[model samples]
Target: MSLVKAGQLDYLNELFSRYSKRIYNYFLKSTLERAESDDLTQELFIRVMKYRNSYKEGHSVQFWIFQIARNMIKDHFRKMKIHKDQFNLVEVIPEREDVGDDELFEREKKLHRAMKELSDEKRELLVLSKFQGMKYEQIAKMRDTTVSNIKVQVHRTIKELKEAYFQLEEV
Candidate 1:
């Protein structure tokens, strides 16, 4: 990061090589669209280079990069003018290796539906924290909030998700 910020253009390639997969996976999880994810991932690195001068010392590069990613996703949705209802919500469902297990497949489907019922904010929080395995502190840094606030939000979001899941189960 420092190297990139210092006008070392070569460092951008190294950084891209190291973080491209992680960034692509994050977008893939969020959008569930491979082509869009790939495009956004490439755009992110471009923005990284374009705005390299904005990089500051003492900041976590992971958080900084993902903050850009989150913004890019928001921009994508805004440009597409797609409502949450129009999103491919089922794409969030993980593919099952045991495709023959009807029960498990049904459960996964139900979970995906329940997750789609969540507010975008709550859903993104869960995706970053639970799915991406980011620490609360790191998430807080990305959001410019305190860790305790993030923890509370994560707890509340999980509780709401469980309620949604059970409601779907009952149906």
Candidate 2:
């Protein structure tokens, strides 16, 4: 039992090291602030460590970690009254280079516009799948849905993104 506990701790540490950057970026995208995202990411790993004993064997670790992140995001939004804070580009916009500022700004504007058009669930799924590189099975487990549902949602989201891109091109 002691050996098992030791192994679990090692695994948890490994998981934290592997996924912290991705988790930080995910939170950064959702919150649009680097400092807040960093704090939340640290809080996430702390929670994982606190609850390590309760993690079931043979379950998907990625899903478990993502579920925790999802809950944290929901709590943050709830506490902050998300609707009151209009999507602010200044929070996430990068510094512009002299040569490509116009092109980059236009592209970022279009991407943000497209992301805003997606439903919250679709946006979250896309972030997890595309940004984090999580598999459909892991996302399904994290979201408490079936893998098939996740696949369908991803397909629809990709189609929507493509449509949005084309619309931007026409503008």
Candidate 3:
């Protein structure tokens, strides 16, 4: 980031190579839309380059990058809300050779359904803390909250998720 800020644009390639997949997956899991994830991931790096000078010195590059991603995601959801009538909620899961277990597939479907029932804030927290494997501290920092509060929120969200999952399983 510093290098990019210093006018060495070539260094952006290095940063992209390291962070793109993780950023792509983060967007994918958070949005559950492959096409949008691709666009958002591409746009995120562009923003990084465009706003390279805004990065704080000595701060975690990953954190700063994700801050941009988070804002993009929020914007995406806002747009999605405005276009909700045109958006298809149905998703066709792509079969993969690696995922041969029918049980696992069904569980994944139920999990996604359960997640959809959660509030947007709760779902984002769960995705960040659990699916994305982000630490509570980092998430707290990102949300401008305390670590303990984030932990408790994550815990309650998990409990709510479990209840939702079990209910879906029962159905």
Candidate 4:
């Protein structure tokens, strides 16, 4: 990143190689639209280049990149005049080897539905903390909140998810 910041355009390739899949996966998880996620991932790298000079010191590059990705998604939604709740119906479930198990598959589908029903903020937190495997401290820094606050929010979010999941089970 420093190399790219220093105007070495070739170094951008290195950054792309390192981050493209991760960024794409982030979009894929959030959007669940393969083509849209691909486009967003490409656009994110373009924005990084366009805003290369704005990259500051002492911040995690991953966090900075993700913040930009978040902004891009928000802008996209705004431009389309779509409410997040209507569009956020897709959630990615990890593929299981036992694909023949009807019960497990049904449960996974229910969980995905419950995840989609969560508020966008809670879903984003879960994506960053759980799926992305980022630490609470890192998420707090990215979100401009205290670690304790992030922890509390994550706990509450999990509880809500559990309740939602159970309600689905009952139905």
Best by TM-score: 3
Alpha-carbon shift of residue 92 in model 2 (angstroms): 4.5
In model 1, which range of ten residues has the least summed lDDT?
A: 84-93
C-alpha lDDT score of every prediction, in listed order? 0.81, 0.73, 0.85, 0.80
| Candidates, ranked, TM-score | 3, 4, 1, 2
1 against 2, candidate with superior lDDT? 1
Query: Where in model 3 is the C-alpha error above 4 Å?
Result: 90-95, 98-102
Model 2, global lDDT: 0.73
What lDDT tens digits, residue by residue, belong to model 2 across residues 1-171? 122345556666678778887788788766655676778999999898887766677776666777889999878666556554654423444556632669878777677677656665566678889867888888787778999999999999989987987787787
Q: After superposition, how far is residue 154 of candidate 1 from its true place, in Å?
A: 1.0
Off by over 4 Å in 1: 77-87, 93-110, 168-171
Models ranked on lDDT: 3, 1, 4, 2
Whichever of 2 and 3 has more lDDT, that candidate is 3
Model 3: which ten-residue window has the lowest total lDDT?
A: 89-98
Q: Which scores greater on lDDT, model 1 or model 3? A: 3
Candidate 1 residues 30-136, lDDT tens each?
66556778799999999999998887898878778999999998787675456645545435455676445879888877766787777666777888998789999
In candidate 3 the C-alpha lDDT for residue 14 amounts to: 99
Clashing pairs in model 3, backbone N/Cα/C closer than 3 A: none
* Tens-digit per-residue lDDT, 14-58, candidate 3: 999999988987877677778888899999999999999999999
Give all candidate RMSDs, comma-separated.
3.5, 4.4, 2.1, 3.3
